[model samples]
Target: MPDNVLENVGEEYEFEFVDVQSTPVVINSLGSDSADVGLLAYSSLANAIQNEMIPGGQSVIAPLTYDGPRYADTYNSTSGSSITDINGLDGNTLGVNGVGSAIDIAARVVLTRNDIDLDNVEFREVSFGAMPSTLSEGRVDVGTFIQPFFEMNSDDLQTVFDTTDAFGSFLKIFVTARDDFIDENDDAIRAFLGDLWTGIEWWKDDDNSETRLDIAEEVVELPRDLLEALVQTDRGYYHGEDGLAIDPEWLQKPIDGMAEVGFLDEEIDMSEYVDNSYLPEEANTEPTIE
Candidate 1:
């Protein structure tokens, strides 16, 4: 999402952007009432729900994006050699951003889906920025990094598989709010969501490529050409021209898969945790993209 996407919402509503470390921290901030609304990875949200970290919190919207191949690139060391597939990870150490994070859970799902023995592999915690360097120095056999990293270091890295390869059409990120906040600020919430929808639509339009690239260049500090290439690649924001929407069935699948993989102790109650009513009418419908 853009840094100031909500700027156009209007004078009546004000939005605050809090930069945090991880999804768990985002959930904790929400639960502690330190944050009014926050976005979190689907798995982390599930973790919060399962552990009752955020009581009466509801997922207001899930910004679904689906470019095939996704951002989950598992790679070998600097040589970009030695690993060919999931089985290649056996008996090797895999570096992830965090142990119990969304990426960690995604790595588990991908590895287990290939029938790789989880016990045979060691998951080491590595920072996102350091993942490439760590893998290059032989500190870890395999490591995962998100966009621009893979694009930036393709020569030094070799892809085993992306998360989409293991679990197709997964929920990427979701927005959550405390029930009290939603109850008292319904109109403000609607206005915020409607403006958010406008931004998503603006972002997904092919005609806005240059404008988007300019913004990307300023924010990510990358070359405009590289950002342009990423935009061309089937980057799945999973949203459609219609608007952003939360699909119960879509949301349930990943939680169920995570639970099945032992990342989550139990299944989550979707009805209790999701409040689609806060979504703008245009965004409350089924997802327009397949």
Candidate 2:
């Protein structure tokens, strides 16, 4: 998508894409002025706010995606485990990418929604790459796993619940910038949003699926079949249909949920962490795409 956008807007602007593995690191990098813009899960944004990494006036400005249930499943090893569902997770150890990560917030929300007590469940820090091994070794009874790990270890795991089942469709991630950056580079930021929105629209079009898969294969070096399967399963990708504009009201679910699960001290004003003035008024109406 970046390549496609650059092909059209290269003369106007250029962006460097860096892969910061986790949300905490992403927020830290943003706080230290390492990057002008960063994408983080909505809950992670809340975490950053509570941690004071994002000050009073700085905030995210655009929506990156709305996630579905294709990935991010709670699983238990198939070895005589009694944890068949969220309710059965009591007294079980759940492995997560981090203690206060997006998955942790989701798990807590899901468990609480079902009246499942969280005190009995232990959340262990396990890396994404190490999840399959952790589950396979019986180190953790329940683990929150996302693709392609979920897909790879389905045979050895039992499905407990999916994130969507806990919380319905919600705003997933957003593009954020510090207050000073947003103030000093308004025009550049708008242009970047315009270009990014156009790229998102291009990628969402069914006609470009093959081209997108080809690009994904080349960039990530994953097997073409896996890439094909991702697009087919409605894997959690960015939503370009919304012109990338953010909705503060929708974000309250994750933020409130985070507090409900004790990840945050209390519910925060979602508006403080979001500014949608730079986005197009209408979804899919980016001028660059036109």
Candidate 3:
């Protein structure tokens, strides 16, 4: 996440990225223990959605996904390889950075979608950065992943499918803030939300263009050229095939799936959790995040 989300909300309030990609459940479990909002990959967020674990009785925004014009470093979509089919992973241990991380939920989503019983498989939590090795070492059949890690490991593994294959599209890295926060500072909330789009735009096709690489370097400590490949490779932010607009339908399906899997304790309506009022009503139709 950009510093703006944390540092520029207003005079006093602030927020920042938590790197919840590692042990997301730990972070989610810590809700209100530390910060008011949580940043989760669409897949990891699936667990919360599945379990109805959001702060209020609603769902968080689903992150966007897209087919890049360039090559993605992720595994093969239809190719016959280690994960030739979903069943290929049956009984095979799966790798995730953390138990509650998005990769875990996303991988589970794929397995459940394929009717694979998760009880029969094991989810080995490792560093998201090290998942590729877990697979190469023959420790797991496939690795659950996000950008860079997903791309970085493409050399050794083949994706049975990606966000589209698993969930019809990539899940959103949603912002889950308290209802009180939204209600108390509607204007600040709107400003923060607008900055989110603008920040994403800077990451995505910005003319300055180093934002994505810089993110990789800052977050992953990768070299500039290496970071560029990590971002520019067939990975990075969404501009989904259909377009970049947020898709509620895309979110609903996965949330329903999470509920079916016993991740959620009760049935909750999406309407209760989401309030799109912060997004410019007219700007919701834009193709990219900004």
Cα-based lDDT at residue 260, candidate 2: 79
Model 1 per-residue lDDT tens digits across residues 39-111: 8777788877777788675564546443333344344455547786878889999998887776677778878
Q: Which of the numbered candidates is closest to the native, going by highest TM-score? A: 1
Candidate 3 has an lDDT of 0.55
Summed backbone clashes in each candidate are 8, 0, 16
lDDT digits (tens) for residues 98-197 of candidate 2: 8777777888888888887888888899988898888778898887777767666667778887666655656777778888888887877777777766
After superposition, candidate 3 runs with Cα above 4 Å error: 1-30, 41-83, 98-101, 112-119, 211-216, 232-234, 239-245, 286-290
Candidates 1 and 3 compared by lDDT, better number: 1
CA displacement after TM-score superposition, residue 62 of candidate 3 (Å):
8.3
| Alpha carbon deviation, residue 84, candidate 1 (Å) | 0.4
Give per-residue CA lDDT, model 3, range 69-183, as digits (tens). Answer: 3322232322245567678778777676666444455567777878889888787776666666666676766666666665555565566655455445433455555555556
Q: Please give the lDDT score for candidate 2.
A: 0.72
